[model samples]
Target chain A: MPQISQLPEFYVSQIFWMLVFFGLTFLVVGRGMVPRVLSTIADRTTRIAEDLAAAEHARTAAEAEAEAWAETEAAQRARAHDLIASAKHTAALATQANLATATARIDAQVSAAQARITAARDASLGEIEWVAADVAQDIAQRVAGLTISADDARAAVKGAFTHG
Target chain B: MHQFQIEKLFGADWAIAGHSIAFTNSALWMALSTLLLIVFVAGGLQRQVVPGRWQMAVEGFTGFIDGMLAANIGPNGKKYVPYIFSLFMFILFANFIGLVPLGLIGLHPFTFTSHFSATGVLSVMTFLIVLIVGFAKHKLHFFSLFVPHGTPALMVVPIFFIELISFLMRPFSLGLRLFVAMMAGHVLLEVLSSFVISGGNAGPLLFAVAGLPSFVLMVGICALEILVSGIQAYVFVLLTCVYLNDAENLH
Candidate 1:
């Protein structure tokens, strides 16, 4: 083993080189390697955070849009429902008014039919009475043929009408 | 290769050596550090949400790294978790590997060997890179990093020069910290083991006497090794983060 005291000039050069090595290694590792690694880590973290925030914003916006759509859809449905009800109500009222007018016309037509029936029955009854009177006058004329005097004939007719 | 200490150049105890190109015991431990980093990180990354044993261990480490960076820097400082975790793993691995007993410089066949041949070009290269990171982040502010803020303009030149000295000293400090820690830990372990082995030839009474203290110390140092492993790694990363913060947000 070469003691520190006995080490020759070559050993001194080795030490000098070692020191030089130290300076170079630290410079490269510290300046080049470490900074690159650290920056990458920072960049990754920042990118992740930014992506999450953007996703969150998009989600919230989508939710708000969905809510607005739902509201509009509901309003449209309500409008359609109101229109159908109004249409139904108007149709029902129109049908009812039509029925009422038809009923009035039918009533007027039935009353006219009844008046015609009554007038026809009274005309038929008058016709039957006239026929009966004619038949009685003919039978009385045949029986009173023997007496030809105007006063007698008139008296016979009156007597016959009274007996019948 | 000629070795000359900086004490001659700078007239001080803290000196620089030039022309030494061989790997030291510290370099061996540092190379071993990669294995630790790989094992821990690969294990951690492969974890499931509901962790297994390996996953739990990795999770514990990851959580610790996260907590440390967050507390010291800011909650967002978790961005530095992988780097900090890797830094911790390397240091911890280096410390543990350093605990292995060695016969001589670069002679041990095990990865724990501190032999000159074991240290590679790659490990030293990495140290330079870390320092550069501190430099790049600070830029002009890096010069000011050594100089405290609020100093008057008249003091700026002297302070700037001092700051430059300190800034230049970072890599050395970092490298030396790992090297010294590894060297010390291994020496202690080796010495204790030698005592245990030598005592085996003595009488049972003598064997038990030397053996007990050596055994006790070995166990104690082993525990201390674990702590040092974690602490050194933490210190490296802490300083790294502080330097980065200074560079990133200069006063």
Candidate 2:
């Protein structure tokens, strides 16, 4: 039953306030909030990317260090083996040289001892020959009891030797 | 003076305290709208995935809301999905409900007091709720939201005061937009429909002539109203989100 004539005058003011409300809301929403949220998102993404990159770098470096260590250990092992082989070789050569020197010294001493023995044996043989001659001459003189002259003895020895 | 022909759509017996309320048809339409919204949403929810026609409609609404949040609030804006979604759905439901043609029976019951209609009450209530939500979220920053950044010291104090006044005006703007649109549509429809009054001898002929234009206009307006209803609902929610954004971010 409400008539148009009774309509309130507040409608005009209502419309005005509506426009004001819209303007302020738009300002607050668009300029103030959106940019901050967008920036935060960008920052978070960038940080994640940086973290991932750092992790990758660390991984690669560790791998390289491990490879280098393995290579160095391999080279050290080879060098140690070579050192052991070379030491054994030197030891073997020294032992051979020492054995040769010892043998040579023994040979020289044996030669000197053989020379001394030959000399001593000849001196004894000479002494023994002299004694044998003296005995034989004494025995012959006693048995025959003949003391003939020297010249006669000489001539008889020569004559007997020619006849026999 | 010409005698006023009192043409009542309901029988002459239909009255509220010996005066006609014209509420019967409007009430029926309102109830029908509410029922349709519930049925559609419930049926859609039940399907959940692998949606049928009804379910697809609901999913479309949800997906659209998701896209809006992601675009406006960023990918992390998914956090506020439920709040935004509920705001959108409720308004959408209310607007769609307004479109049902229950003749003169569709006016809301609870919103009606001794003086004002329920539709008007709903608009004001919705507006206040949005304002409070914004305030609760931002607190002090909500007040700062109106003042533009990078103002000079001389300009700052005046601008701050103006901003404060403007900030206080939000609920009025939000509620009136919806209320005006709805009230205008309904009043226009009612006036047009009244022209096809059934009077004794001239009823049929008069009804035919007036009914054609009225029906055509009503149909055209109805279609437009459907679109307006949906759009208004979206706008309401969009503004709410914008307010929420201001409060939280302070810019």
Candidate 3:
């Protein structure tokens, strides 16, 4: 084969070029490129880890804030309930006092009105009795030609009202 | 033989001392392979956190080599990643580039690995590294690689010599395997192609008998050639790692 016969002729040239090319290959691939690729991968991993940590931190803070807000809301709710209860109690007391005062005033006014009505009725009855007595005296003098004094006529009328 | 013939690219051979050093077809292919390798390596060096396809492919190869070295040589293998990575990719690219049938387009695809001179240099390089690592790391204990573990005292000496011979043969064996496989495959294709041509020139019956079957076989072998290229590249790197393991670990 020409490969055997021609070995002495070409081996040096082949080896020379090979070493030159492969040596450069090693430099570019190993020295130049690999470190950069590895670094990039490392950077990504770090960034991802940091991002995850931040997310966890934010979540924890949010949970704590929510807890604080709940406590405040609960406290506010209790305070509002207490205020409402006290206000309701005060309103009830005021209403009771107003109702009692109104009832007492109304009672006094009614009693005064009752007293006036009783006095008016008594005055009307007295006038009516006097008018009846005068009528009786005049009738006795005209019909019987009897001389009758006003006092005696009154007494006779009273005796007749009392006897019936 | 014609495929294997080397000619002067400059119409003259460059000689150093008494040896003829010519820029030949083999040198041209070597340069082409290296150029493409640079492009491939450069394409993948985008250095983005999330890699593009080119970068991913580059990572995939590097990762594959890293894993292999880690498996074979273990913890101390980290330092050899670049060298091993280059070796694997160089072989893989050369093997694959050769199998590309550029002949159909009136161009010859030369497999430089098929040349013993080229394969020999690569094997010697791997062998030298193994020697250096073996000596550097384990010192004199690296000599224990010659004898298998658990041998009887009586058989130790003989086993050592035999193992030593095989160990010595490693570089040549490595070179020979690749050179023969690549050279033989190309030669076979050329021979079969010749048959198809002769059959076609003869008559329809001969064409149907020889050309057709040979054509079918060529197609089948073309597929197999693609497979072999990958496998051979894998085997070469695997053996390198194994040899390195012996040197590194003294097993």
Candidate 4:
């Protein structure tokens, strides 16, 4: 085969071209092209890494903001509970004050009614005593036909009423 | 048969001192391959943050070679990425370019790797680099690479000679393997296609019977050649890395 033969005529040109082409390929690809490709790759990687870091930072900030919001919400909730408790305490105190005033007014009305009832009972008893005395005086004069003093009748009636 | 014939393109028989120089089809194909690589590299120069498919493919190839270098030669192998990657792309493109059927246009389909001159240059370059690196790094101790780690005094001389021969044979083996594999595949395809053509001339019925199987086999071989093209390129690079490792670590 022609390939097996080292025919210097064919080999010389082949070698010459091989060196020129291969050397050019090496110089162009190894020196010029490869670095460009590598840099592009490196650039892309760096950009990705930067984007990821930025995303991570944004996520951390968002998490911090969320935590702050939660803390504020908790504080507001506690304040609301405190306000409700204070309002409830004031309402209970006001209800107790109103009840005490109503109770005092009712007790005063009950005491006045009791005083009026006692005054009426004493007045009725005095009237009853006078009537009894008069009757007794008249009856005594008629039955015995004796002249008795008005003062004596009165005194006897009084003593009888007192004993009854 | 006609594909292997070298034709001078335009250069005259110029000789300097004792050397002859002429531009040929082999040079044209090599130049074309280099141009393809240049265009390939140039196309990816834009460096998008979000790369398109072509850019991704280029980067993927680079990463593949990077991974190979790292695996075979360790972290220090990163420095040789350019040389190794260049070798890989050149061989890969040469093999693939060879498969293009340009014979219809009466142009030779140049299978550059099939030529020993091309593969020999590549292999010799690699071997030289390995030698230079070994000697530069290890100096005289580089010779000790031929001596086995555990060997009797009597066995040392013979083993050393064997190792030396094997080491010297690296370039020839590397070059021949690629050349043979590529040449064999192409030759088979050529022969089979010729059979189909001649079978058709004999008789339509014979053509149908013989040409059909030949066509089928041709397609199968074509696929195998494609696979072999990639495998041979990978093997060439892999062996270079192994040689580099041997040089670097003296193992």
Best by TM-score: 4
- Looking at model 2 chain A, which ten-residue stretch has the lowest summed lDDT? A3-12
lDDT of 2 at B36: 48
Candidate 3 lDDT over A35-112, as tens digits, reads: 666566668779999999999999999999999999999999999999999999999999999999999999999999
Better of 1 and 3 by TM-score: 3
Model 1, A1-164: lDDT tens per residue?
A: 44344356335544553445443334544344444434444465687899999999999999999999999999999999999999999999999999999999999999999999999987875565555555555555687644354445455555654586
Chain A TM-score for each candidate, in the given order? 0.70, 0.55, 0.76, 0.70
> Which prediction has the highest lDDT against the true structure?
4
Greater lDDT among 3 and 4 belongs to: 4
Give the C-alpha lDDT of model 4. 0.87
Runs of candidate 2 with Cα error greater than 4 angstroms are A1-164, B1-36, B46-49, B104-139, B196-211
List, residue by residue over B1-251, the lDDT tens digit for candidate 4. Answer: 76776667876667655666667777789888889987886776667878888888888888888889899889888888889989999999999989988878887788878989889989999999999999999999998999979889999999999999999999999999999999999899989999899999999998999987999999999999999999999999999999998898897
List, residue by residue over A1-164, the lDDT tens digit for candidate 4: 66756456767777777888888888888877777788888887888899999999999999999999999999999999999999999999999999999999989998888888888877887776677767777787788876777778878878887898
For candidate 2, the share of real interface contacts preserved is 0.00
Q: lDDT by residue for model 3 over B170-219, one digit each (tens)?
A: 99999888888888888888888899999999999999999999999999
For residues B1-251, write the lDDT of model 1, one tens digit per residue. 01111112222243354343445444444444554555554554442434577655655665676667776667546656655655555556655665554435653423222323223332343445545655666565556565687889899889888887876666566656655565566667768877888887777787799977898889998898778766766776777666555554555
- Superposed by TM-score, candidate 4 places the C-alpha of residue B122 at a distance from the truth, in angstroms, of 0.6
Model 1's TM-score against the true structure: 0.51
TM values, all candidates: 0.51, 0.46, 0.76, 0.87
